[model samples]
Every structure is written in C-alpha cells, then in structure tokens.
Target: MESRRGQGSLEYLFMIAAALVIVLIVIRVLSGVSSNTPNQQVILYADPENFPTFNTSDNYFVYQTTVTKIGDDLYNVTFKAIAKRDLSHVKIRATLMCNKKPVYVGDQYLTVTDEVENLPKGWYISRYWSPIRRDEFPCEVVLYVWVG
Candidate 1:
C-alpha cells in the first residue's frame, strides 16, 4: 500500500513539471521572442544604375547616402551626387524603393525635388526626401536627372 501511495505522488510531480514546461512555452510565444523574427531596421542605399543618362555617362555617381528617423517607421533619406564633368541646368528627382518596390507615404510615392543650375566638374549635389515611410528594411534611392 505504501508503494502505491509513493507512485501517486511521483505521478503528481511529473504532471506539475509538464504543466510548467507548457506555461514557459506559452510565455515565450506571447512575448514574441523567437529566432525567426524579421528585422525591421531600415537602411538607406544609393542605386548604382545612374538613370536618365547624362553626357558623361561614367562620370555621374552617388557618393553618399544618409538616413534619419523622423517618426515611427518613418525616415528622411538623402543622396549626394558627384559630377565628374561640367553640368548645367541640372534637375534631379528621387524615388524611394524598398525591396525593389516603390514606398508610398499616404497616397503618394516618396520623392524629392532638387535642382542645380550650374554644377561644375568635381562638384557635389544633394537631394533629400523627408518623412518617408518605410515598410521594409534596406531601401534604395533611384534618381532621375536632366541637364540642359
């Protein structure tokens, strides 16, 4: 009879241990602690394509990229362009692309408008967009430039 009592006590302890293990798993899941969590950090980058071709095709390059947080999940991005040859009436516009898709803030796409009438060779020009919402990490800036 004593052995039967001991067996019952051991079974009770095992059940309690199992319950604690289940509770721990539940807590972990509720806290959103996991290895598969996606990274939400944003990184701004410059596109290397050099779109809207200029006379000195190989001379245009994006020399710098800057990103600053303006609000929750919102950022301001700036890209600086370096000119290798004389450029005049330079008009530049930029679009924000996240994961190869354009990022929209409200109902419009995020963009920037900046122009330099005379950019001499070896000069740098910067264009920026403020309060751009980013839904994904590692976004790129695409620039469309015109020179007259």
Candidate 2:
C-alpha cells in the first residue's frame, strides 16, 4: 500500500513537472516574438543629365560647363541655350554635345547693337575661366564652338 501511494505521488509530480515545462516553453515562444520593431525603408531622388548652361562670349568663345547635382536613377539630359550673343560686336554660334550626342546648336548671324561701348571696356566679365580676346578681332566671324 505504501509503495502504491509513493508511485501515485511520483506520477502526480511527473505530470506537474511536464505541465511546468510546457508552460515555460509556451512563455518562451510567446516572448521571443516582437511587435515593437518598425518596417525600415527609405526612398531617394533621381538626377537629370543636363540643366544649366553657361555662355561667356567675351572670353574667346569659351563656354564653361555648369556642375550638375546627381541624384539616384537614370536620366535624359535637356538643354536650352540662354543666348548671350548680345555681349559684343562679334557674332557667335555654338554646337553642344554630350557623350558625342548633339544637344543644342545655336547661331547668332545678326550682330546686335554694341552695348560694350556703353560700359567702359576694360575686359569686364564675371567668370573666372573667361579670357578677353583684346584687339584680336573686333569684326564679326562665324565660329563653330563646341560645348559639352
């Protein structure tokens, strides 16, 4: 009778221990899951090939290239000549190319009224790369300038 009672008590303890183990596993599985984490995703912008154009006719037909702001993806460049042919008595024309592709081709065949005479002519220009072709040729000429 004593041995039977001990066996019954042992079974009861084993059942309790099994239940406790299951409960612990359930708690661990539940706690391991997280709901507080965020969905981390970021989006960026795209860049165009051409936007700004520079014209410096006073500096020997040299057109300085404007810096572009590069963004995320692929792009097709666009060009519109902000014509500065009104600088001097010299007529000008420029052919713009990017990656060996012609973008903008412009010509100033007609000479505009000289306004450089109005401003005291001592090689007045704002650009650093611009050089004044002083006394080189005051008269007009058809120039095939390449701007890239």
Candidate 3:
C-alpha cells in the first residue's frame, strides 16, 4: 500500500512538471509574435506619376512631390525643383495643406553645388521627413521660392 501511495505522488509531480513546460512554451511563442510585429507600418502615399507639381513663380518651379508614410505620425516628403537662372542665394519653402488648412511647413537653403544653378533645368531638392500624423494624409504640398 505504501508503494502505491508513492507511485501516485510521483505521477502527480510529473503531471505538474509537464504543465509547467507547456505554459513556458506558450509564453515564449506569444512573446515572439509581439516582437516580430511592428506597432506602425510604413506605406506609400501616392503614385509618383499622379503627384502634383506646384510652380508658384517663373524663376523657381516646384516639381513632383512624393509622400511616404513612415509611422503613425511620421512622413517622408521628397520634392524636385528647377531654377530659371543662376541664384547666388535661394530659399525653398514647402507647406503641406490638408482640406485647405496648413498642417506642416518646412524650408531649406539651396546649397551651391555644381549641379544646381539659376537655369531652366530640373534638380531634386529638399526632403522633409517628420511626424505629421496619419489623419493629415492626402495633403496638398505647395512650395514657395525666394532667390537672390
């Protein structure tokens, strides 16, 4: 009879150990799924061919503007430009408007590179990558130019 009691106790301990191992396996699998999943996924906003061009002035022209969603509140905006003449000093300003309301603004000084001059030629210009919120999508980007 004592041997039978010992056998039952050993069986109970074995069952408990097996249950613990199963619980650990489940926990590991769940952790791995969460780690592999991203909280925010990146997505393209608009097709390059469909992107709009904003030419506010004759001396400076704004080319295609492409927007990429990088996070829940982040975007990567790349736009092209062209100068009608050689500008010793130039300032390019970009404004993102949603529903006719301005949401974000950015600007950059044109660095004097051998590739860029005040000429009627296309040149890739500034990139604005920052958090601008997901609700502000489908925004219209307008670029203003100041050259001296």
TM per model? 0.44, 0.21, 0.38
Q: Give one digit per residue, the lDDT tens place, for model 2 in 17-40.
A: 999999999998875563222121
What is the C-alpha lDDT profile of model 3 across 18-104, one tens digit per residue?
999999999999987765343322122322234423333343443555666666555655555554445544555555455322244
Off by over 4 Å in 1: 1-57, 69-75, 99-109, 131-135
lDDT string, candidate 1, 82-126, tens digits: 877888877666666665343444335466666788988888877
Q: TM-score order of candidates, best first?
A: 1, 3, 2
- Looking at candidate 2, the ten consecutive residues that score lowest on lDDT are 38-47
Among all candidates shown, the one with the greatest TM-score: 1
Ranking by lDDT: 1, 3, 2
Task: Return whichever of 2 and 3 wins on lDDT.
Answer: 3
- lDDT for model 1 comes to 0.60
Error of 2 at 11 (Å): 99
Best model number under lDDT:
1
For all the candidates, what are their Cα RMSDs to the real structure?
19.0, 25.6, 19.7
Superpose all Cα atoms of candidate 1 onto the true structure and report the RMSD in Å to 1 decimal: 19.0
